[model samples]
Target: MKAQTANGFPSVQLVVVKNGRMIKNSAYGYISTVDDFGEPLMQKNKKPITKETLFDLASNTKMYTVNFALQKLISEEKISIYDKVQDFFPDFKDKKKALFKGKSDITVEDLLKHQAGFPAGAQYYVNKKITQKKKTDKRQNKEIVLELICNTPLIYSPRTEVLYSDIDYMLLGLIIEKVTGLPLDKYTEENLYKPLNLSSICYEPLKKGFTKEDITATEIRAVKRTKDEKFKDIKYMPVHGTVHDPEAYNAMDQVSGHAGLFANAESIAVLAQVMLNGGGYGNIKLFDSSVLNLFTSQGNFFSQAGLGWRRQGLNNSYAWAFSQLASADTIGHTGWTGTLTLIDPKEDLIIIIFTSAKNTPALFGRNLRGKYEGDFYLAKNYGAVTTLIYSAFKNYDNAMLDQMLIELAVGRNELINMIPEIYDNEGSRKDLTAIMESIKEQSKQSAILRKFLKSEKAAAILAEIQSRNSKKSLAKKQAEGQSK
Candidate 1:
């Protein structure tokens, strides 16, 4: 953690729960070294990080908030996954003179599986969006945003591709509100969060009485996510104590279905524990066990994902937060703001990591060093914390774990070489790839757990980590014991 914080992230919170119990929970670093305008902050102005600090959940809100509401509605027979989305909203029809296609065929299940053919996202926060006829106020109205999505042509036919999109959950959030006649935040708080006693989990932490110091800042300054000329406005400030996602913040008023959630590590783990507990934590039942099974199991369209949760599968490598050593039943999701949640019902384990990965300035912009910027952030981050958590238990196959680590090391070689964005120039890319290749060669030739990392020798050096649990090591007598 000390080494990771040395990069660019302002803070990180990690919580590991095993067998329905919190085994480890901790927070590190500061609240903000810079204020909401990208201006520098004094040393005395920054606040210390703590376990109670809330963080932007980014996309993980799809699991804890949207998925939770869907499961509850399903349990009460208020809705079915097969129900067409048009059934809920009376005006959810294709626009009369728009290029919209196949709007009537979208099912609730397609939305959950992210096969509804919505684009990955739209920057509704920008004054001028593509599908809109005219620029509204600085932020878009919720009704207008929904209308835009409805009018926008489906990028692909529904059920043909498994692209992840915030639009799916944004619509689902509305569905929850429509059925319960309550806002998304109110419904989740009344039914799930408040009942579970999750004190710090909610949308719009600031409006709920949280100070800036109590929540991690996402960006040192808000930057344009698009190249549109209208996005040239310089009024953007550093985002703190608010939703980092543009659509959730600017369109749906920071209470959208896809994002706009803030919670500490422990609160998320407790919610994850509900899945492990078969739909209830303690006596507070949120849904039936059948709902849990239906949501967490692999979906027919994409085995890599369940309903809203990403599951362990052939495509699991993209989920940097989930460990390959985990049981095949592991289901989890990550956020753009650097939050992670993984729940394995088969192992009764839950891991949550909250990080403000974008706390650094975006002068260089996007993945320039996203992973290198923080140990908890991107492709450069490797199989360490989660893998070590799995190693702590006596169950999983040791040989398989070792093999997974080897593959990870090899993956680092392949992944970095493939991505041209992380490097500054061709020369830098060659230098970095060469360094990775050297490390891989060394790791292959040596059985001893010598320097295994390109940077820190032992950092994520999992090749021989299982040796610590070997019987041979345990059988050795105490060396030079004074009180034998």
Candidate 2:
């Protein structure tokens, strides 16, 4: 907490769980040091952060809203990951069919893996006023945003590459609503949160009766204007007890797939614990073990991502929130609003960090670096804390070390080049080689995995998976037709 405060972020809430029990739940720093207009305030104007302080979770909302929603639907057999985007919203079939042939090829799996080829995100909210002629038709905003996403040209062919995108998850949220006939928040609350007994997690906390005092303040809209021209002269206000992402706040009205949920550390820890327990907590089973495995396993994509969680791999940097010593199967995610959740299944550990760091001037071009340096500080703080936590567990066990060696040997030759930091002795080297030989003999995906390892192209492997799935689906349909 002190490191984060000294770096830039003012407030932080940390929760650590080991073996499904909370070991640490604490808060630090003030929620705000500046007022709504980015002006420095007196000490009396500041509010100290606490354990219960609600935080604008930003992209972390994806895990609870889009990811969990999809998992629930899949477990019910309502949808398959191989289902195409065109299958959900057929209106795209008639709209720009020739220009965007890739749209029809994009699958639910593509979006979940961020291999759908959508651009990162657009300031759709800023242009909404100019784009919409009828100002009073507020309900059409969602449709308009969807149209914008549909009209967007693909950056690459579907399943050809991985590009982390908010647009992908935005569409996933819409799919959840379309399939379940419930708002994203409603479905999650009734199905996931209620069962878990987590009452503190929800979308749009202010509308849900949370007071301004109960939630931490985020960025001032005015400060954001200096960085992006889209925000210039826009109605400025302090973000308190509300979503922070511009698209979620302005376009989606605090209900979006990519962002817009608010939560506290304790509630987030509960959710993480459920994930660590393989989709169950106590008597409640939100999903089957098979579903959890499918979602948390390493993807065939560029980033080693599962459905919505990022799996630890050799490519991951030390600045990442997960420990370097963590097993490859570890799954977790980070939020843009200074939040992190890491679940180490092998270690039976969960770590949650929530902060309102954007409330400080450092996030708005007022820091010593003279620009938004929050990302760097956020990574540093999260990485340092995670390292400290894992370090407490003593040396890495043989299983953990073996997994690291396999990962490094498979796709991370660069790490192998710097061997002293990883392999201390010739004995470890011989052990790694023997492990590799054993893996070569035992693994079923060895051939395919070797191809991907050699090529170092995650997109190619994932695309192959998609192609094979499509062929199987077509063959199944034909067989059914013949039987009938």
Candidate 3:
């Protein structure tokens, strides 16, 4: 396998798919190194990272937790997608009056959609309220943390907004356990993984045969690195083997619902494939196809949300490679551990890219830069839309322009959404193409379009769109010319 820097940091594997099959799969970078503390983590020999070396999936575990809840619901016909949390857990109704004045208003739908108004992360992990002490040798710790989280107050009312919260999933996971009388991990194993043949996936930490060398690494946090204050100022260092995300680590009783699920590229691909199959692999229906669609459905008031997995569209676009496909109907999740899973239903394909650079302090701090680079976005669209924007400019058409703007706006508003700032910048490409698509779709209305439209402002919007388009063209041309 060949490796390359996605943003600036070196990564191990990069894979791609199109129309339900693999297109590209390559590997790069070293797997192990000697640390500053003299601890040797990762494969010391320049071993090639394979499809089976399980990587800590970080927040991507949200998919599993959500699936666990869905499975429980399937087992019991009583489960309604619209059922509010208060109905199931009445204690939540009035427990946190200061926050969730009416927890009954929050539905299971809201929990998965992130519209429950829970903060992204609750600081309870490091707080004294949650005990880290080992109580009951063989007892699972999630039950203990579940009690703590249920007692914690909601940060805001439900359904008012979508705020990413692992706490929300943690509570949801606990609720699953409570209702089904089974642990989340056990339920998910019986329902999702084994049926899919995702043998490498596991929630527990790697024990004997598996080591840091067997997994891709991620996150460098401020832990017990030094006794002296002088060394405390240093940021992240390369972390391997152990889970580095404090939130996920803590929730798992130092491991969690938010993170800590580990699997390799192959296992992840299998999971993605199963999802693309719409809840079944061969003979088994892990979940109902409609239920799977629910998980991937985009929310109405919000951009998108069906169940645990996010929906396909511009509003929720997470910059996955499949996201930029011209007829893209792809959706997937990204993990805090430099992991990306993109599935295109239209194409019936999945792409899994996992990098270990997040394991170092410098790498951790530079995460924002890597995401902002938008390589996936560029990779997906740069080939197709480059000329469309310029064509829209060449012919001044407001009707065309209006259509483009509306589609792009809808893309931002409803589908694979980018942040406002980034959306405004790159969204122009989609806006331009949408105008062309809409204009071409409507011919008889061309007269009404002419009657309602002006000539000058239309040309101006077209010109502006063209200018941005032209710059990219010139850059591409120059790059190609230089290569020659």
Candidate 4:
């Protein structure tokens, strides 16, 4: 792990895995809080965030739904990769008109790729009827979802352009329920987690390992006495311990197919390892490798999609685990609340980044204003390897520099030759320097790169050349400073 920060959140955890083993597992920031409205809320010594802390994994829940659907289909041999959404959910019939102005057809493949013509958000939270129900009454989430889709309009035909929609996955979840006799949660728990030995993952809050205060607080909304707010007190209503996303919380009764998955980084790692193992983690085969490959392979209809996972390097951004150093065969997804799990098949690696930053009222509503409807917002920064490499080289530590460069070379041999040039170019050099300065204090492994990244022994001949060039540039800068 490298570069963990609150960034105006309670806590965050970053992790790195290679060969199915954790190379770094680090935590940062406070876990509990004190004052809410000028008085103490949590009265104990603040517990620090750990890798085991259960985070609100907002949209990370999508992977589970996809996995469950795929697993069931594979089990029954009822569907193929080329299957269309129209095959099962014929309700998408206006699907022909769902395409963009000048596109082809929309496939199940397109929805998975996020190329479907649907907006990224919906206003499911503000529905007074849904919230007005007694807190003890079980939410009729399935019925609410039915009404939402029945009422909401489709933005465009499928496969038009890349527009993310929670409704798309929610529809898929409904499809899963249609195909399988059981509820989505029950099917997932019995089929997905039970088989994989994943005990900690869940959509609903559990009583054993958590409490009302254990969960992170997300937002603070202004309260109104009436619709006109003529008699309302001007104070923000405390939003803590509850699921922050209204549509997602409403979808699954706080346990939806698209969002509201709660799990620690460790449980996430186990799920990722299943993907790494080609649908089998240990002795158990969750699905055959062929089915796994089908899920991970991009099809002709969609430029970048596996069955449920998005292909890596789409839009120059990783759909998961930041951007990886591995091949495009990599697959993963990101949650709305700063949770991400990325799997790299080339290196057999899984990187899990989990944070409760979404629950912080400070950062929650800031970015959610302009276009997006979801009130939750999480920073998209990911995998710190590039920053680590740049830092090691800039600090002039020959050993640490050589080690990281060698690792990078081993990870991807082509990038090895470009190292010196990358360090020599003014723009690249400055970027590396800046990144190194920013992350150095927070990570001990990163600190090692600062001291020992120099060329060493017979293997580091390239590093020797790079070091000489760096030294010359440093001298020129120093001379220029003196002149100034």
lDDT tens readout by residue for model 1, 222-290:
665434424236756677777878788767878999999899988888888888887888888889899
Q: How high is the CA lDDT of each candidate model?
A: 0.72, 0.71, 0.56, 0.57
* Location of the lowest summed lDDT over 10 successive residues in candidate 1: 371-380
Best-fitting candidate, scored by TM-score:
1
lDDT of model 3 at position 298: 66
Residue 348 in model 3: lDDT? 55
Model 4 has an lDDT value of: 0.57
Please state the error at residue 299 of candidate 2 in Å: 1.2
TM-score comparison, 3 vs 4, better candidate: 4
TM per candidate: 0.77, 0.75, 0.66, 0.68
Model 1 alpha-carbon drift over 4 Å, by segment: 6-8, 42-45, 95-100, 127-140, 223-236, 314-319, 363-372, 375-382, 394-484
Model 3 C-alpha lDDT per residue in residues 1-484, reported as the tens digit of each score: 1212221233456555545566666665555433534244444444456656666777777775556447547645647767777676666654633646656687777777777767787666565434444454445556556556656666776666678788877777766766668776776767677876666777764653577667765543435432321333555355566666666555464345667777767667766766777766678766666766666766545443456665556543543333334233456666765666766676455667776645333311232343322232222232223223323424747566555444442443333235544444332343343453344345345663443234554454455556767997999999999999
Candidate 2 residue 53 Cα shift, in angstroms, is 0.7
Is candidate 1 or 4 superior in TM-score?
1
Error of 1 at 471 (Å): 48
> Residue-wise lDDT of candidate 2 within 1-484, one digit each (tens)?
5544533456788898988779999987776656655566676777787788888888888887788878878888998888888888886543454443577778899899998877899788877442453747655567778877777777677777788999999899988888899888888989989888887889988788788777888775433422323433556656666787878876776799999988899998988888887778899887777987898877775445888788886566323578676777777788877888888888999889887756654322222232233433433247656876786665755454334435534433323335544422222232334334444443454454444345544344334435645876899899999999
